[model samples]
Target: MERLHHHKVLTTVTWLLSIIISIYYTFEKPHDGVWPRRKIWHQNDKFHTAFRLNSIIASIYWIVLFVLQGGYIAHLFSGTVEHVNAACSVGSHFIVNNLFHFAFVMLFVRSYFGWAELFIILNFFNLSSLYFRHPGYARFIHTPVVSGPLAWTFIAIYWNGAIMVPHPDTLVARIFGNIFIWSILVYGLFFIVVYKDYTMGFNLSVLSAAIGVSQFLRQVVAFQWIFAFVIMAVLFVATLVVAVPAATGRDIKFARARAGDTERAPLLGEN
Candidate 1:
């Protein structure tokens, strides 16, 4: 109990510090620079085709799971027979409700923090405590987040290299742009070396690659529901024949009605 209280107090302090740092970075002068213009993967038609296809594959992957999940939910209501539909709905969940999670995570990291933020916030508390412990440690905290790697990311990603060129007319703009491009590579290398979180790291890398392609190629956003639906329809049929991962599962407690009726429930089964 005491340990839990200690953790809660420390958590509160970290959150306070993160909020302060986040606000400062938000309105502060834009120090982020842009990568120089170059041939990115998006410039090639092959890449767009691939991305579209992935989106289609991922979308179909979600849709199938959605319908199946609904049916599974219905099955769960049946006390005797627990019909399971073990399809994975992760792809759908991501592109729909979780789409905002991705954008807010990378674009405005403070809003989308998860385990990453917890680590960063803890650093904030440790540094703050350290500063208080020392008599003359205030000076170093001019940039408090620099006290740790996780917190340093806010500065590294935002202050070091920008996604867009801030000032095209200025003389130093070109210099900054060149620096920004190189800095991104350096940052990615640093992250890969330090943090081995494949899922988050891989997703961010893909996002960077996509940004590079779209920015360079001047890709326009177009609404193509029909195109997506067509791709989904095709994949749905293929899913029946192909061995794919199960989409989901659930648990429902029930009282026994008779003897010799023992059946273990599967996690991915639905109504």
Candidate 2:
């Protein structure tokens, strides 16, 4: 009981600290006279590629992601036995994630792109570890808390790398960008097809659409935006076709197993 209580306390404290630090850096002016963290993309627009997401889309997505996290927080304190145990089981993972996330934001806002990329990459691995560790976590709780960030950070690896390199927008760069953009499609589908991770597929699809819109607004005649939009469509369709059926099958099997167990159990008189 003491251990569980400690886990809950630690998780809540870490989450609060992360939120405070992230909000302050992202929105408020710092003593260093640097632009607020949220403005980094606009301030560094010269380094942006066709993969950049629209600010509006990015804003809405984070808002929704935070809301989902809020739901998980509620679950952590729900007072139900199952909820408490679930929260404790995953508390450590969330603590590590929050620390890495805020640290990444700090480095990123300070223009330490190389170090920022390293932190984000580390967070990516952390999230992947969580995903494989708890593959059966309820989607409603797990999707936003884990899978959402995982998908974003997976693509962010490429996005951050691009900014860190700060290359010229040359013909070759655009050509390679167009080719590599499809890798996001492949990444999203692998999870959806192999693991039936619809949450990842959905999050990646939304992100891809956001990138497409941003790119289209940037260059109306570019191949990157068109390919991005296509990727979004494919990911969304793949989730519907692959994950939906697999989930339905799993639920059906679970119901049948429960029925079988009930039938095989001995009655009180027999015992």
Candidate 3:
């Protein structure tokens, strides 16, 4: 009776929360300040003659994310469907599935903007995934075992211009893009490995690296040498910063696991 009551309470809370979030995203003014109703972009363009493309892209991206995330939440709580493993499947149904959809959408939208930095921002999803994992939000996001590596690959491609713009000669923009992409990749590798899925991480990392190298080679041969070199340097530094801490943490976790196994083995042998 107690277990059944607990389950019912959990289900009720989940439904209520989902409904609330859905309503908020559907109607509320976005905190990120990119509302379609506002003419901020037009106003800026008229006065400054400088295009704030990143800001515009960021705004649109936020709207898409809000809608998709909201829809996924609604689907989970609709209660019109029944199946075994419904509880376990809820996370995958919305969060993970919608993520790929979201990525594909971003890919198309990014092509219009032609800004590598904007696409690089997509890497933050990995860090967001990791942070959410602590609260079991990973289950809610339906974040897959493959999300982290996939994110890294996306970042790599974005940086190398496979997924975003190759032009615009601004050092500051490139630097910001590099930092954002690298942070996500490093953070992603940590979470993916911690989840005990090294194979996926390794495979994705290698593939992304290969793509990055190939892109770099193409750029260099085409005489876009300065941008390619600078971007590569930024990528190398960012990778080191993000990967080092994650790798160290993984080593400690593995050591602890081995010790526990050794201790348990002796007890079992005595039995």
Q: RMSD, each candidate, Å?
A: 18.2, 6.5, 13.1
Report, for every candidate in turn, its global Cα lDDT versus the true structure.
0.30, 0.72, 0.36
TM-score winner between candidates 1 and 2: 2
Model 2 local distance difference test score: 0.72
Give a tens-digit lDDT track for model 1, residues 1-271: 4653443344334434433443444345223434221211111222232122232222233343334334433332334332211111111221222222223223333222233343434433443343233212111111121122222332224322232223342446534433444443444344333322122223223333433443334334422222223333333333322212222111222222233322222111222
Worst 10 residues of 2 by lDDT: 262-271
Best model per lDDT: 2
After TM-score superposition, what is the CA distance of residue 179 in candidate 3 from its true location, in Å? Answer: 5.2
lDDT of 3: 0.36
Sort the predicted structures by lDDT, highest score first.
2, 3, 1
State each candidate's clash count: 20, 0, 2
Residues 96-165 of candidate 3 have per-residue lDDT tens digits of 3334333433333223233323443444454354434432222223223224324433544443342233
